[model samples]
Target: MSKTNAARILDRLKLPYEILEYAVDPDDLAAESTAEKLGLPPEQVFKTLVARGDRHGVCLAVIPGSAQLDLKALAVLAGDRKTDTVPLKDVQPLTGYVRGGVTALGTKKAYPVYVDELMLTFETVAVSAGKRGLMLWLAPQAYLTATQGIVGAIARSSPP
Candidate 1:
């Protein structure tokens, strides 16, 4: 398989990860759908989100696809008064990654990366490979180390 920017970075770090690929549905880019395509639980498939804090600049939020980011919680963790998702139009320009393909590993900007504390609960978690239709699965610690991610309660379960 061809390497993505994220894959090359991982290789440089010597981080061992498994790459998984699935069919893409341009009309349905939801993380839940991606999880289903891979036959994995929604919680195991993480989604990368970019947000800007009032006090801080832009940052990346890696949360479970099954969960929703808590702006208030994120703001507290970011040491800011508030946090808001970056506009869809700005995602690619800001992070060098488009929606559904943003990963903390490789970005246009090295914005602070904050991962959901819940991620550590799992033995392995999946994240975008900085491209659509691809995901990287590795030990939680490996991911944290790769991105120098801050672990905190930055996410809350979505309502049923």
Candidate 2:
């Protein structure tokens, strides 16, 4: 079901993408860990985060595995007073994809999407393929076009 959704999205966009599957230990499901397990650079891997803002409504943020989402920056970008992570329990139903499988593209709802500027450093980036153990490698522009996402610096340096 997950791979099907991702394939459908790719077909619709007419974009070329490569799907990479790897073994994922349920207990270690995190972007950085996943990247390490896949032998990919952390900066080339992105994590989809669901956040709600006071005025901009619910939005999706895609940031590097090594960076943190800058709530204040996101709020400013969304023209809102504040931003908060959406509850995990509500994420699946809200995005139509399970927790670790959430992708900015092909979501159940069409919400505003913001991509961290860091992703631009890579010619191709990896993101979840609507399922755990599966990832898609594609050009960053394809994601923006597919999701109608806005690109900006909504990421902060990882806590030291």
Question: Could you tell me the C-alpha RMSD of candidate 1 in Å?
Answer: 0.7
Off by over 4 Å in 1: none
Instruction: Write candidate 2's Cα lDDT for 64-106 as tens digits.
Output: 9988999998888888899998999989888998888899878
Task: Please give, for residues 1-160, the per-residue lDDT of candidate 1 as tens digits.
Answer: 7888998888999999989999988889899999999999999999999999998989999999999999999999999999999889999999888888899988987999999998999999889998899999899999998999999999898999
Clashing residue pairs in all predictions, respectively, total 0, 0
TM-score of each: 0.98, 0.95
RMSD of each: 0.7, 1.4
Q: How well does model 1 score by local distance difference test?
A: 0.92
The global C-alpha lDDT for each of the candidates, from Candidate 1 onward, is: 0.92, 0.87
